[model samples]
Target: MADALTGVSRALREAPPDRVVEAADRAIRSVLGASGTAVFVADYRINGLWPVVDSRQPEVADQAGQSMVQRCFSSQQPVRDGDAGGRCRLYLPLTVWGERLGVLMVELPQEPSEEVAARAVDVAGEVAMALRAADQETDRYRRARRRERLSMAAELQWELLPGRSLSHDAFHLAGQLEPAYTVGGDHFDWSLDDDRLTVTVLNGDSIGLAAALLTAVTVNAMRNARRSGGGLVEQAELASDTVYYQHRGHRHVATVLLELDCVTGRVRAVDAGSPHLMRLRGGSVTRVALDQQLPLGMFAETRYDLQEFDLDPGDRLFVVSDGVWGADPSGRETYGQRAMARSMRATRLQPPTEAVGTVMRELQAFHADADLRDDAVVVCLDWHGSGDREGG
Candidate 1:
């Protein structure tokens, strides 16, 4: 076991930036006496599981749609596939913490012992960490995964987001953007520092590349304020000041800035033209009313109100960009509050990660077969307060 661990570590650590996946695959196959090996990386941004490296056929690496990979990814467990009586393949989920990366495939010469299966799981995690590093340091693997060309604006917005989900002892939050391949300017970001969690929900109105630039500037300004120990209104103020002066008021960015005391479940918010902030409790969903102010870049003297509330255990908070509800205030063609209420009810029992995904899928079904789909975003937070009062 020590030798196997040392070999896997050396293979990934010593490999060149461009060849991490290939080296890991080689090491896995060698250690397990497998006839072949492969790794498929999931790029949820584009909804694809593309092949990075494969020793057998290149066709086998793109098997994300195959039943085995799908089962392994969703269940987040290792899958043994001699049940179908083919060549006896094993699929392992490559995941760390709460984040799901992709699938690892190992082809055995024969059915392996239980020890081999256990060891393969450990190696899969090391490979996942290496893949994360390669994704940042090298371009080869990323370029291979791009099945479609993204507009320069789309690329910027995609990078502005904090991955698709985040979880910890105090809260679980997940968010997603729609029309992911060619988004306008919809991004959500979050940071958990010490016991505080700050979140931003933004929607920029500019089109094309301008929208992307607007989002980039606004989100950074918000982060700067939050990291500097500013509250909700201060974050909104900084974002507005940056956009108004930098863009000369040429564009406006709508947003909701959220600050949570992760330990106490106390919630505070500043709304600068965000569409809605909904809370789900018991079996129903209701809008969390807040004082509204002009969007960033709209007014130099615009001031925001800091809204406050306390979330108990089992409470959910949702803030959405206009794209999710549509730009229409008239509510004729848009996804209306009634529809949203139903979805919140349906997904109330799911964890935050699954809840956001479920809502996105339902939104797509609501707009199915339509050529024009706007960029939509939703951030869902599930809060559980610290149990300091339990003894009372």
Candidate 2:
């Protein structure tokens, strides 16, 4: 009997909060030979303690409820005597830090004596200590998780942000990335060389270990493809080919590439399966419906197409990733092309970063506090060949 009680004490001391409560209830019923046991926690209203776990007698289990527990809580003392109506009912208040936390009730087959009352008190004290220890553990876990998330968020932001903007007097370009996690698959890059201004975006819907691999492949493939001897069309094809060959036809990816001449303000683009690119011109938005090609590495028979256009001084071109299209409000209403285009038209006068932020905020509000399902990227390119528009 002493050894069993020692084991119960050890369990209460070592277990977490949930386990501590469970162990306390189990020990009382087993050691005291109680017919039923209950653990009640005080409600926020402070008027009562509600039973969390109720072990009731088969004869009167249905009749006994929280109200029956009122006298024990009201007296703020243990009730164990022949005067009680049932076989035996013992109520011991579970207190901590000079405050009553709740009540622990034990129903006995006979009136409990002084020996049982003393043991019940000891058990209640152990339960209180266990509850405190469990609270401490829970608090520690919450702090650790908060710190970890902050660190992850910081790392993700640092990696995705470019060191500087890729803008000059002739042409201006900027982009924004908003991930639903610490790391996301939406990425855009722009490198200005002596020959051409290379621009690319890699939109990956990957996650977990696969997402990490996709990110590495996307970054390395873009760098290698841009450095290869090629135009935008050739570079995009090279990137697709590299991914396909590297994955051995096991994985798939989506990519786009563009080369703009600083002198002529001509924009050449190669779309390799991504969301439609929108062009805002003269107070209106136009969806440049490039051909829908297969994602990279899907199959050997996939083909790509290239398109070009002359950029007016005030023209704005927008490239979006699949994350935007995937986010649906109430899981039904999509922030589709029409909505995105409208947002584009409305924010045409805003800077690239602000425009993207506006769109993201709108999507967030539309979802009504739901979490973003995917990472999103938005890149805006504008031609300033005429030097007629204000910088934003």
Each prediction's RMSD to truth? 3.4, 20.5
Look at candidate 1 and tell me the lDDT of residue 314.
86
Tens-place lDDT per residue, model 2, 1-392, is 46656867887776666556566766777888877777666532234455553244222233454555555554456765344555777777765533445677777888777887788877777776676457555543222213224334334433544422354666666666654334456677778787367777777646544654665566566677667756665565666677777776677777777788777777777777775577888898887766667777676645667788777778888887877766775757577646776777877777553466667776666667466677677777776774432333
What would you estimate as the lDDT of candidate 2?
0.64
Clashing pairs in 2: none
Off by over 4 Å in 1: 53-65, 83-88, 327-333, 384-392
List where candidate 2 sits over 4 angstroms from the true fold: 1-164, 300-303, 386-392
lDDT against true structure, model 1: 0.77
- Model 1, 80-166: lDDT tens digits are 876354566788887655566678878776787899888988888888878777777888766766667878888888777766677
- Shift of residue 27 alpha carbon in model 2, Å: 71
TM-score of each: 0.88, 0.56
User: Worst ten-residue run, lDDT, model 2?
Assistant: 139-148
Task: State the TM-score for model 2.
Answer: 0.56
